[model samples]
Target: MNHFFRYFVVGGFSLLVLSCGTAGDKAQAETVTERVENVKVSPLKTLQIDREINVSTTLEGYETVNIAPSVTGNIEHIYVEVGARVNAGDLLVRMDQNQLTTTKLTLANLSHDFERVKALSETGTVSQQAYDQAKLAYEQTRESVDFLSANTFVKAPIRGVISAKNYEDGELYSGTPILTLTQTHQLKALVSIPESYVPFIKAGMTLEVTSDIYPDVRFPALIEMVYPTIDASTHTFQAKLKIPNGDNRLRPGMYARTSIKVGEVNAIMVPYQAVLKLTGSNERYVFVVKNDSAKRVRISLGKRVDDMVEVFSEELAIGDQLVTVGQARLVEGVKLNIVK
Candidate 1:
């Protein structure tokens, strides 16, 4: 009888322990069932947004010219130095004028001989061939003088500032330029655009440009040229923009950001916070509530306005609930407890 009581008590304790373990597990499971994440969702809506393209490029002078005399000669004097502002027709350099002076004296002597030859020919004392020879010699000498005079006086072809002085006074000018002139009052920038935008971009289209040096200023730019051919390697076309820098504040080689409005696009607009970037990649995604569960949708982003951004995705539709808040904690197909 004592042995039976011991066995029965031991068995009863074992049964109680199993029952308590089962009850504890049931309670834990119930608690886990109540732990759904609370999120706030906004219904996606379609809106018309301005589609803009942004590209970075370096600024350039409107006109950049390397000024050099046509004929090779000794540079007698340099009238301008680096940073000197010059106008059109202003003499910038003077080559050796010894050749010019000698040619001019020869022309003068030929003129007198030609006059005497003409007088003789009119009186039949000199032959017509003699008069023709004198005239040709005089004309040829005069042409040489004119050509020498032009090369001796090197003038600025455009109104601009001298950016470089490659030669000094009493230096022999070979093939290199004497000076580098650049028009800085107006600037230009070449931007490469994707071939897809060729149809939308046209000459005279206005764009907004900003430089890193002057961050707050927005200079107005106009599309001055559109290249006819697209680069086969890059699959992009080039566009030249004219930016007015009347104050001479902007300089060439400065970094610039250009923004152009291609047109309007219809896109699904969502709060900027709703988008999340995937770790270790440039891929972006968003979580939307579908039938009380979070659904992850990959999206391609477009232009962002104020607090909203444009997203493109075939998986998302108008009126779909997007989780703007509490998206970080959610995962694919996780149960959602949406709150206001």
Candidate 2:
């Protein structure tokens, strides 16, 4: 019995010693955590930083025109194909018009007869009634001749490359866009501005644009037009910026990002991570340290670019040191340890 008691007492003392060591360890951890939870804040600084806002957009043609058939006829020949570079009045397509040629020949004969009759009337060999009738016929026949010749030939309206051709040779084409030619020398960046910004948008202001297709390329643009009124449904005003695409790099239907200078002012801004998004959405909070205790400050946030966010609220003043590096682990009235 004495030996069993001795064994039991020794085991119990060992267990007690182990519990005490664990408790000491836990208490030390709690003390270290308390010290580290302390926070520090500095005054905010007012800096004159150039503000840049990024917008998503695409490049578009300044002017797009469809080459619809002005005269009715069957396609006899196609002089140009897609991507063919042509100047104004260059032949693009031709229509088969046997009847038109025949009509022209008939008109020519009538014109010659009418001229002879007019000459006879001047010589008093023909009656005035005959002369007047012959004169009218001659003018009418001349117009017919010109019309027929035009119907047989298809021509380019301006200097441009044929981007599209809808009709094939021997296909009947009438009043349909046989080809689409665009002068890509100039491009336009289209954008819609909110109603609040309409008054500030002025023509001749500069714009900068970029596109995903050409990541390294930036096109200098100018404000071309601002619509006079706002769209009722969208509550936005339409705006356009012109870009010189003489190199043909900026094509129609290309996605572009456009930036316009709206306003510039000095505002208080801090590191992006300093502003906290609580509840994961619209709620914004920032930790401001006062006397080693972190005060959770709810801030009204504005434009942000890269790692900095603009804090517009009056609660944050210039030269106020913000806890930028370590803010996520803090709560209201929590303490933080400033490592730096």
Candidate maximizing TM-score:
1
lDDT per residue for candidate 1 within 1-340, as digits (tens), equals 9999999999999999999999999887675455588999988888887888889999998998998777888998999889998999999989988888888889999999999999898899998889899999999998888888778897888888999999888999998998999998899999998775677899999988998888899999999999999999776899999999889888988999999998887778899888999999878899998879889999877778999988877899999999999999887766889898
What TM-score does structure 1 among the candidates reach? 0.64
Off by over 4 Å in 1: 1-47, 116-133, 265-340
Which candidate number maximizes lDDT?
Answer: 1
lDDT agreement with native, every candidate? 0.89, 0.76
Candidate 1 residue pairs that clash: none
Give the range where candidate 1 is weakest over 10 consecutive residues by summed lDDT.
Answer: 27-36
lDDT (Cα) of model 2: 0.76
